[model samples]
Target: MTDYQKQSPMQAIEVNNIKKSYENKYALGQPDSKEGISFSVSQGELFGIIGPDGAGKTSLFRILTTLILPDSGTASVDGLDIIKDYKEIRNRVGYMPGKFSLYPDLSVEENLKFFASVFQTTIQENYYLIKDIYQQIEPFKDRKAGALSGGMKQKLALSCALIHKPSVLFLDEPTTGVDPVSRKEFWEMLKRLKNQGITILVSTPYMDEARLCDRIALIKEGKFIGIDTPENITAGFNKTLWSVQSNKMFKLLTDLRSHPFIDSCFAFGETHHITLKNNDLTINNLCRWLQQKGHEEIIIQEIKASIEDCYMQLAQNG
Candidate 1:
């Protein structure tokens, strides 16, 4: 038995064989919306589910939040059964959906107060829990939620989610549309919240953000590709990755991918990330080959593997 199974009862969240589907009936070849998904989040741990837009992240979140039920499986939130104790689970957890779901016409303060009322709590009662986020948007408390900038709206939504002092928080792509600065600020807030002992389950499509989590599960096409700490995940990538650039970037990508010795090639920032199929692949040989192919200003160097690289590897293998 693994550590997870031995401590299953102590986890803040537990999901076992959770499966869901949107098909009305057996369509000979339709895939289940989500299949055989399972994972656990420990108390006060910042666990992240990283994947692309259609990778069943929202489905998993909806199931865990009790807003939607899985077709088959068992799950628990904060030690309470998700199905049998949904009411209690709802009270003990907070949820922030991807889209701005707050009342558009209501002012920021009004929205916060309304959510507090739903939980039979007041903003003043849990003011300390969300002080940092609330302070940033308190200056415009009277502004309509829809009128606030993307980042401010995000803060307001988070403030409202924490009004009841829930033990576990679920944020689904909370920084999807926010600016880079706000994205950084939001992560900082999460780090602080984790220190306050709130177990957080956050999902994001950004690979860079995966590094911020204590541990991350990479999901793709309705299944998990890999799960581990960011450092471990990247370090486990057993490949010779290189960052290559040339005057003809498009041609460089095309040519490298087609090369017999290259395993994979994809554009990454200003350069293309290349993986060699053979262990003997070298930068000097690659540059010389590209030069012979009419490429100019060719630059090639071995680069450290990143979470994105690991994710791609998992996707390919699975």
Candidate 2:
């Protein structure tokens, strides 16, 4: 329900009970990736896996991209079994890992050609697919990939990934270290790709980017705590929330959490977001208490729970 209509009855991707761990250091979950990791992505839907680092986003992506096998699970990409049809799956999907994996010594144009050839295709054959992105770096065709700026490198990697015109695209933390402008431009490109009927699965650590997806899965500690549209996720919050700020911002958080009427409190940028335990006290009363604690410049404003606030609450309860 990403607001994007399904173009096909067959799912672009399907996962069931996918689980993995490294020497038990990073298990997806106790059993079945915490009651089993299962989800389906409709064709042409732009789904996002939003979480911080070490949340198993990369592990999940690697399994789907055929870069590695899951310890236990069943998955299909483009209707091809991840295990039985992995070879064909590789041919039908494009993967861009968190790090730049392109050949460092090769030129930007050369890299694109090489990836296209691996799929037994040619850049010219699918030039229309990546024309907009490639044109931005076309002038740097001869520049070595390793020598290009981070933004340019990102564009090159993306162009190469799309050169084969795969049915699905997997991007893992694609904007992790890129500049803000590049990140913005990259998302615009993804929107365009989605409009062209490509199903995109992207993961990002930026909470603010959750709104860009048709739907998002909030993963924490290797498990998905919540999955839904950004609006719905926040709307599901049942508690009363407020944003409180004071001159002593750090101390304000500590004081707010210790209050009996405050159910939960967490620092959100310049303000401390809190949910009330009950209607025992009003905002004016809370401000007075803060003033008693030697706080100045008090500002308390009721606000809606954001995705981060929702994530915090869900992670705590999950």
Q: What would the C-alpha RMSD of candidate 1 be, to one decimal place?
A: 2.7
Residues 48-101, model 1: lDDT tens digits: 999999888998899999998887879999999989999999999999999999
- TM-score for candidate 2, residues paired by index: 0.95
Candidate 2 lDDT at 287 equals 96
Question: Residue 191 in candidate 1 has what lDDT?
Answer: 99
Once fitted onto the true fold, the runs of candidate 1 whose alpha carbons sit more than 4 angstroms away are: 1-9, 24-35
Residue pairs in steric clash, candidate 2? 32-36
TM-score of each: 0.94, 0.95
Which candidate's TM-score is highest? 2
Model 2 over residues 190-305: C-alpha lDDT tens digits? 99999999999999999988999988999987788988888989989988899999999989988998899999999888888999989887999999999999999999988988
Q: Show model 2 residue runs off by greater than 4 Å.
A: 1-8, 31-34
Give the whole-model CA lDDT for all candidates, comma-separated: 0.90, 0.90
